[model samples]
Target: MPQAVLDSPFGQMIMPALSRQIHANKRGGGILGIEQQTPGSSVKPQSQLHHPLAKVHVVSNLAQLDELLAKFQKSCAVIFFTSATCPPCKTLYPVYDDLAGEVGDKGVLIKVDTSQAFDVGSRFSISATPTFITFLKGQQENRWSGADPSALRGNVQLLVQMAWPPHPHQALNLPTFSNPNAEPVIFTKVPPLSKLLAKMGSTASDPAVQSIKTFIETRSSDGPAEATLPDIAAFTAIIRDSISTLPTDLLFTIVDLLRISLIDPRVSGYLAEEPSHRTVTAILAHVTGLPPKDCPYALRLVTLQMACNLFTSPLYPDQILGHPELRRLVTTLVSTSFLDGGHSSVRVAAASLLFNVALANSRRRRDGPGDVLPEEEQVELAASVLEAITQEEGSAEALEGMLLALGYLAYRMPLEGELADLLRAMEAGGLVLAKGRGLGGCDW
Candidate 1:
């Protein structure tokens, strides 16, 4: 017996008279002798298929469709026009649902049964029993008829690809992505060892300090195979124990020796990957606590460079970003030195360090769940950059670096709390105006 035709979004589905169109009622009235290939002429057996990627929302009314469209105005969309009486539509149901699930947040998938959603079907001229329409950024991109599973899968996958092309960072091989065990930065020109030792004077006499200097000199001339690095555990302990008793000048010189020794991956990598991170912590404390005015320009620059060189070990950044005190120390140093235009090199180095920090934060955000840096930390960093930009005394390179640092810190941050305040501060500093002045590549 034929099932009673009732309310359906598909409205009366018409089909060609054919015995092959089995499992369907005979009351189906449409143009006779029309080719079975003329759309809605074939129905394959249904099977269970899983859709784990995304959910296919059933749009019940025009209002629901409008809401979905507006909500995903900036996203990709796939709308499935289905019918109640169309067996071919039912056959393709599993394939369509699976495509939706696979696309996830990258694309919005919707299913509308025309028998129950005539208004939506009429809006898109969807008179056929089963049709699929894809939209990119709220605009209709492609539409096709019939319940061809392969075609449905291909077009939906293509829509997802168009919506989210691979991230630009994937193309960039950044320092943060380098092997943790890779070699450290080596100064191309070696300074005279005698002069360097003479400058250190009394501190050079310390066994641990002297050993570090010897290792750096030997490593530079003879290469990693020939030079033996100092016992890093002993060196770290000695520095920690001796720093308390040392004068500010001697402490600064010792830090410089540590900087030079960092040219060897053995030294820097050990310090970076230490279980307690005591080496980096001690170094940061000494460097940040140094009397700014009394510290020689050379010592200051080397210290900043040493901080930047920490990227040699991939684990170093993860440690730094996760520690509040360490993050504050780096950000404070970067903010202050970046504004010190009188020392262009210091300012630039500071900018570079900030860039690395920002980049690290961005990677953390993308790599997994969890906040890269605390919201308070991001706000503080943003404020520092905003103050520097307001002064506008730095070089273009410094400015560029500062902007990048701010950008990373603000990327994907919630628009509330200090982050919101930071945005307002940036506005007050003429960020919008500056964007209008040819710095157009950034997107909020």
Candidate 2:
């Protein structure tokens, strides 16, 4: 009976659902003998257990009923259900048992056998067994003849609201900026975007992608010296939201943006919507404009193809060597960076460019057994690299790039004395020497 009462809110209509669960099992409805709860317990209902109803007495004999009602009158509610023979009537007893405190505040639930109290049922017009009629201050207020949990809760909410209204003037705890009156501002820690193909990474079949590809190819032939994108703030907004997700598609877009635009548009380190840059892919790119694709700007543009390798403009290697200006530019940037130690950011960018050019030179020298780089060309490449190391002298990033470039060269050029000495010098720089630093949180 207790199980039925507790579950009644969700399961009173179970008879119908039960028959549906197991086909043909749902013809008629009857009690499954759920456990009953005691009255005047902590298990009292949220509704009415605290209401002011009436109290009514139950007596099996007509003569005894008259005496009991006379003794307790003008009270809270009374709960009188059905006899043992009535299946549904048995379900209410457990409910009444656990929550009898209602007898004092709302009213009392009393059980009476319909067969035993036939004359009483006829007086109250009780047509069904276990019918519940709640009385308030000696007058009936509500009645429930069928079991419907949702319907029951609906009525309960209404009743509870009438008795107690929710807090009227309560305030919500919204975040308040320290400078609430400060000027309205949008954060600019996100990258710039080109409108030619927004959402390019997501819309796989979008028409914009084809249009942009065609535009790039056509422009490459003889369209414009620079394909300018609109200076729209919305593109910035798009990037701000995009980088926060740290989606790989967004990273691909970053790569594509570099490929399409010869210049590396500035990117902010954070988003306006978020307070942190924990997922940002490259801090150097955000702060110093040093993403892999942006390094060529520090070096002059070689031929379009070398420029592409240096990450200036997207061009294949074969096309770049054909241009004398680009070839001279690559040579000049590498030579000057080693000769003059200017800005650290520029130096870092310059070293990377040199590394790539060395690797390219080494590759060109290996095309055939009869081929060897001219002595002057080999000296230009070697001096360019050695100059970078000499200037950085001992910086970590510079040394690392030097080592990588040399290792790449050694693999291709089959090093002898001079190149071997450069390799030893770069190794002696010890770029990977920071392993014994603090174990605590980083300064960043």
Candidate 3:
């Protein structure tokens, strides 16, 4: 029942995004795919769940892994979901650690990058970091991959109850999907994790990341930049001096490399792994397009980290902020992050990225040679974030960050009372109620 998700790289890699969509499977075994929703499928949705929080690191060396696991095992339930370039893993991980905290005595939460534990992940049937296999009494249990937190909590509680029965309680129920007015709301679709979902059962050499290779070949400079280059030799070095320790998917590597590279830009132009800033933006454009994939959120977070590392070059973010694709993506992330999602953690993360992007856009506009666009667009970028904050007023995370952004912008540009008024209302006791209630909400 613990069949790993090797056959589906996109599914494996984007499981973090998809993890939130998981359904319970009681017919036994793991909750890996949408077979339950498949046409003519008789197997009812099972009772499996994805509640534990996991920490995943794609390591190529055992020494590093041992260092992490040693410390991790001593702390909590760590199910090491792993695989070679597990693409969907990040989608699932954002909450892996949170879920792990609930699995007391049920297991330890951990992950082993398949590249390092090829045999371990493979032997355990864990073909991806998005994989979930519980550990109890020093033994691993069945593997599952679903996005249902309640189901996961239920199952884990059951496991705990079986080991040490507690007073009987009611089972968790799934949320019902009801049509709201049928008012024709625009639906923003998340791009499929990748074009390789159907190819997971195929060989690892599948043409899943063909674009990645081309991307790297095109954007890659002649060599590394001397400035901010890091000692990520471990990340890029060859394993056993033979096989590439490098990830099979260029996007995965880019995401990871960017995270580390951002800390130091002296390694400038080395990461154009796709060609001009235009192409780099395009690649990430594909990523951000998948708002649910967390690519937009990931790009902004990565941007903040890498912004400092970029040499005096506009090519990178120029393509980014200028790209309608990325802009649209960020907008989607800011607005629907909570509206479209039920998770607070993800909403916070999404809002954080939105705030960063808006600030970056504001800063970029300020740096331009000439003033362009009416004062509206200038304030638009920042105002939208403020609007999101106003909507999310009750949320300390969203309100505080947004209020700060508004404060910073007001100080620099001199608000014409609108921004100032909202800022004051937020600071006063009414912001939270004013949030969803509208500026009209604080009409007092």
| TM-score of every candidate | 0.54, 0.28, 0.32
lDDT of each: 0.62, 0.39, 0.38
Clashes of each: 11, 32, 52
Q: List where candidate 2 sits over 4 angstroms from the true fold.
A: 1-190, 193-315, 321-325, 364-373, 412-444
* Residue lDDT tens for model 1, 99-182: 766775566789998899879988888878788888888898998898778888988888876766544323333332222222
lDDT of 3 by residue, 107-206 (tens): 3445667666666655666543465665443344456775555655565555444433321110111111011111111111222323332332222233
Candidate 3 backbone overlaps, count: 52
- Kindly report which residue stretches of model 1 are placed more than 4 angstroms away from their true locations once superposed: 1-190, 290-296, 339-341, 415-417, 428-444
Top lDDT model = 1
By descending TM-score, how would the candidates be arranged? 1, 3, 2
Candidate 2 is scored at a TM of 0.28
lDDT of 1 at 86: 91
Q: Which is the winner by lDDT between candidate 1 and candidate 3?
A: 1
lDDT of 1 at 136: 88
